[model samples]
Target chain A: MQRIQWFKWLSLVLYGIPMLLVLVFPFIVMVSTSFKTLEEVSQIPPTFIPRNPTLENYREVWNIIPLADHFRNSFLLGVGETFLIMVLGVPAAYALARFRFAGRQPYLIFLLVTQMFPAIVVVLGVFRVVVALGLLNNLAVVATTAASFSLAFCIWLLVGYFSAIPPEIEEAAMMDGDSRLGAMIKMTLPLSWPGLVAVGVFAFMDGWNEFLFSLTFISNDEMMPLTVGLFRFISRFQIQWHHLMTGSLLATIVAVALFMTVQDKLTRGMLAISEK
Target chain B: MSVVVCKELVKRFGATVAVDHVNVEIQDGEFMVFVGPSGCGKTTTLRMIGGLETVTSGDIFIDGVRVNNLAPRHRDIAMVFQNYALYPHYKVFDNIAYPLRLRKRPKAEIEERVNTVARMLGVQHLLDRWPRQLSGGERQRVALGRAIVRNPKLYLMDEPLSNLDAKLRVQMRREIIHLQRNLGTTTIYVTHDQVEAMTMGDRIMVMRAGKVQQIGAPEVLYNHPANLFVAQFIGSPAMNAFKGRLETDDGKIVVATEFGRFPVGDPLVARLKPDRSPTLGAREVICGIRPEDITLDDAPVTPASPQAQVDLVEGLGADAYVSLTIGGTTLIARTPADCPPAENQLVTIHLNPNKLHLFDPITEETLLALP
Candidate 1:
């Protein structure tokens, strides 16, 4: 290899350092704050590295609220919401890809329009429905609203993937002695593993990161998920940024772990991987 | 004996009729080829028989049982698609054994059958490999193996060799014919290539615009086509067709056209006589002659022979096709390569009187063959 050039180093310093600061500096701050004392966090000429690191915030954040309970609630809601979204999304995607009906284009456009609305708009409408159902403090309202919002986009993503698979594959299965549904399950599903993984990850991450619906629909302390639980560190008098960073890092770790588990299934698309 | 029958079957997709009222009966152990150009309803008819397509009208009988509403699975048939739709997830062995497994056959039996087929197709070494790993010819054999392993009553091959290279297509064509004969399953093969139909089919069904033009043995179709469409469709370089008008002088029928004034033979005269109608005479006609039927001559050897200027000569190994301009028309004559006419050289082409086909210009129906 050629020796490294001075301009290359200069470009790397100019471009890469700024990118690292913009993309990675926040996580670094979050991490350093979580291990610092409240006094050290607000100190003028803030330290890049914690001068004195302590685990006191972790212990305090865990004890100040039901951290484990909030985590468990978030975990359960994410899993349930993702499962429900997939159950609704996969079949809808298959139908849109394979069949033609009079209102199909309009229906698809309507789903896209629904996705275009900001979460601020969705949170209030879902809150109204939750209140009307007498479920303001219930986690079910949060999970349901999260799944509904994610379902539309998940269906559209899967429609593109499902349409990529040729119908001849399923028809060949049918000729080989499977019913229509049997063909789909045996042939289409296995071939669609990538799409399924992507949609599942999308829905799960959507639910896990949602703050608006969880905040609006869940006010009870026990029913609140990690997203709403993060705000418990904030009071009218002062914002406990260290405890907030601790909870946020813990949530990020779990999300990363979930993604790691399903990463292999996400590698291949429907018909492309099978081609020589 | 395996058999399939389509009685007045018709299929329509919205306003476009993919297959018109079609009738076909495939006999036991017969290789029936559906030959046509693209959009000629050949594949649609095959799909209808395979039960992949629902019939818009009429009925289908499989082995003498009316199977109007039977699913493809229950019809006891296997189809080799044009793309060789191998299951991407399954290994070669499992792909071949899938149909047997679906029938709840014993695992041991399934393996034995798969092994036998793989060995027969010479794909035993690739049994554990995915379809993507195989060559084009190997994939075709695997597809053929999958179809034959079940020993179903009927086999439908939809342009199965169309995806391969020219040499491989010929090899696979022979393999399929050999495989089908050994299996003795009634087969209906669809193809747009007339050469494939001519070489492999025991009997070819020529189709055009969703209608059956003619159905017969290959030689019969070559010798006597029912209409102008079949005449133009069944040959490789296609038959040379020219416009002409029929006339009678001194009890002899003569054709007058741009090509030349040529006297009609006895077979054509009997077809034009008073039997079909007393008032029908002096009608517009289309005359056809196969490229091979015309032979080049150095001089006028016969009273009816005509001379023309050679424009192009295409040499194809053992034979040569000479293009000649007779007045304003170009005629292709299949001559032996040894004596092909040089460009700009004048030559006479003597057409066979017995092989002349005359068709009604308007209706396009062959006038010579219809009694």
Candidate 2:
């Protein structure tokens, strides 16, 4: 028994070390490079940690690139798009989960078909539509389009979540003097909070990092989101390594922070779907 | 309090009929139960009356006023579901106060009613806790409290005690019966367990294949079942049935089954036809006998006795279930627990005439009693 226990511990450490390194190594490299000067970043074996770490690269990136404006734009667009997706997706999901109506199957199939198409294929058409609507330089257009793109996926996630809740709960509410709509609000919606959070976080991440739509729709540098603004650090001939690393690190930090906040909900939603 | 009447109620889902023209009158302050096997439409019928399910075609009357088109809330009925259906996030107090809150009752009145019902159900201590924090029995009491606070015209319970452990189910069953009696609310409960129906209902509606087979007081249904289904369903160790030919010997009728012959007393024998099919349907009848009705004796002192070897003995403390094989047929005899015969022990068994049930093999209809 002791030998087996020793072997189990040895194997756990052996497996865990590489997994930890793989996950943390990239973030460590990015953070270290963010603090290094342009000269230090171009060193012959890339330094694990900066020899003389400084906040100079962060100040340069912030001053040279409108990094603050990009941050604000990204935050606003991501939150707006995620909120819209949830507003439209939650009720649609509850309807699909609870009620049997005409054209329900066809509607679900159409929604699924939207996810099957690659976003690049429709980029030109989407650009044309935005231009025709006179929304080419507007952040609202990018936010709305991104939200529209994520709506189907969010609804799909929420449908599974809503269905996982026992129908008897809603029926019980109905017996307690609630209308069908009231029952959905009182019982079904609250029970599926984890799914809502998971979908919200996913839409937020997608909108935060989306590049093609933001780049095509918005020409004003001030309106550019983080993903598009980050490209300003790179030119055709050379890359500003310090500025690029700082900006990337900041974006990574924001994404990771948002994800960590809702990580429990995401795991729970995924588990609920898999169980069904 | 008001009586509920369902007349010629029919509910069809596509091509299948769930409740086929069921008609029942539930009296005011009476506890009525709809009992049957799964998919027998007992639940469907209850839901129709509760207005949870739309009636395909029927008239449902509460207090002699037709309520076929009324919403469940408008009909003033409260239901307790099989899973308890307590809102997991709500405290027990909030759950019990839900109906009153929906009615926009005064806050103080809601609080008083919620507390009163919670105290009655012995769940007053659980009011501040969420449903997930309570045990199964506690959750059930909160669900009951939620229903009782409404003081609706009628109460509908759909196997509310089914999810509990056996001991808790029995305890809750008694509590529900006592509570309903004290409140004097007309109730319509649905359950697949005949034991619950027999013990708790003032009258049980036994259904099969979307049709009601019998409806009567528990003892009446047990002693005089309307058909083969009721005869088999109501008893604990379900009534044993033997297929046999009915024959007249010396101007007396005898049912000659594979197990042996049993005399059909004069009144019952007259109900059998002499000329019957080779299927043994006319002469062929089913002899229904409860296990308790078969007497096991050491000696065959009577002419109406059949000899058999005991196959198995199940001692249930209060009674012994002895399985015996006679002429290639198995028969269960309920005897005194202390004097149970051993397996393979030879014994003479006699079928009590008064306890025998005769049914037409073809129609599966009870022949002894005419309705």
Candidate 3:
């Protein structure tokens, strides 16, 4: 047993450390750059740690861009996107999983086909529609765009998740004096908590990090989400690398913190589908 | 009175008829069991009555009210599913109390009734436990408690004990029967096991190929099956069947079979009644006899007793089933365990004339009735 434990430790060190470094090295660089002086950020052969760490970058980043407004915009967009995705995707998924209807196969295939195209491929056409509708600079438009992109995947994942639970659970509830809708609310929804959490997390993350749609639709600096607002530090003349790194680091931390709260349920939901 | 009546009830799924013109009236407090092989529409019939499945045609009446369009909840029925269907997230107490809570009963009433049911099922200790923490038997008891708590007008169980082990099934079978007797609530249970149907039901309805084959009391179904299907299905190890011809030998009617010739008695012929006699002219027939009716005892051997070579012997604690073959025809005979004949031993076995059943080979309908 001791030899096996030693072998396990050796293999982890050999393979795990390099993979961790490859994934986390850029975040480390962001953290270092966020704390470094402006001059230290530009030094040749950049140091792994800042020689002189300062809070100046963090202080000046809010003043450089409307960081508070961008945070609010991102928060609103995430809430709106998550709400829309769940309200629309859950019933569609339940119907897909539970009911038999004409053209269900074709409709599911259509959802799959929609997922194949990246946002870049449809941005021009969407921009034209937005221009025609006079809906530019609208945060709701950005939220809706992001939600539409992830809705298909949300329904697809939940269909498998919901189908794994036996239908007899709901039938028993109905027999126990609940209506069909009530049975779904009391029995099916609670049983699907993990899958719903996973879907909600995905939608929130998509809205929080989306850039192409926000940049195209919201030209207003005050209305821009964090993803687009961070771009203000970049220009043709020069780049405010210190302030940009500081802002990006904060955004990453917020996203990571939100994810940490739901990762347990998210992994369980995904595992349930994969096991099936 | 909680009488449930189904008149020509039918359930058709697209191209296939799952239940065909089934008509049954369950009296108040009757424990009715539907028994059949798998895919025989027994479950479908129970589901239709429970309003889980819609009727393709026909009407269902509960307490003399037309309930064809009523929902399951509105119909006042409780069902125990085969897998127990306990809510995994709820504690046992909450699982049993949920139905009462749904009806918006007083909080005190819900609590009192849930506790009462928990005590009755002997699952009071498990009230705080989730379904996943309990054993299969405990889960089954919790499910029963949930169904019993509401005291609905009718109870429907879809093979509730099929998942239990043999010993647990028998124990649960007795508990359910005792519970039903005490409650005196109308119930319709569906199962494919004949033994369960015989033991639990006040009346058993047998189905095959989407049609009810026979419906009668346990002893009636056992002693006088309407057709070949019920005759073979109702008994364990099944009844021994032999293809033979009705022929007169020395002015006495006898069934000439491959095993041997057996004299047909006058009462059996009289029960055939001349106008209803389908085998008047020495026509081909199928004769059946219960294993217990064939004696393997070494008593005074009569002339007509057939000699069979014992091929196998299976001894139970008090009885043994001996597999015997005569002229390539196999017949199983039950004998006392202490007097099991040796394998390959030729034994003279007397088949009781009163217990012999005759069936028309072409129609597969019983030609002889119980006297």
Arrange candidates by DockQ, descending.
1, 3, 2
- What digit string (tens of lDDT, one per residue) describes model 1 on residues B247-333? 766767777777577777777676753543213677788899999988888887775667899999999989998898998888888
Q: Write the per-residue lDDT of candidate 1 for residues A142-215, one digit (tens) a residue.
A: 78878887889899999998898788888888888999889888887778777787787777777777788888
lDDT string for model 2 (A1-276, tens) is 999999988887999788899998888888998999989989998897899999998888888888888988998888988888888988899899988878999999999999988878898999988888888878888888888888998998999999999998888888889888898887887778777777887888888887888988988999999988998778898888888889999988877886788687778755653432
Interface DockQ per candidate: 0.59, 0.41, 0.52
TM-score-superior candidate, 2 or 3: 3
- TM-score of the second chain in each model? 0.96, 0.94, 0.96
Cα displacement (Å) at residue B361, model 3: 1.7
lDDT of 1 at A1: 25
Is model 1 an incorrect, acceptable, medium or high docking prediction? medium
DockQ, computed on Cα atoms, for candidate 1: 0.59
* Candidate 1 stretches greater than 4 Å from native: A1-14, A262-276, B272-280, B302-305
Off by over 4 Å in 3: A37-39, A259-276, B273-280, B297-305, B369-371
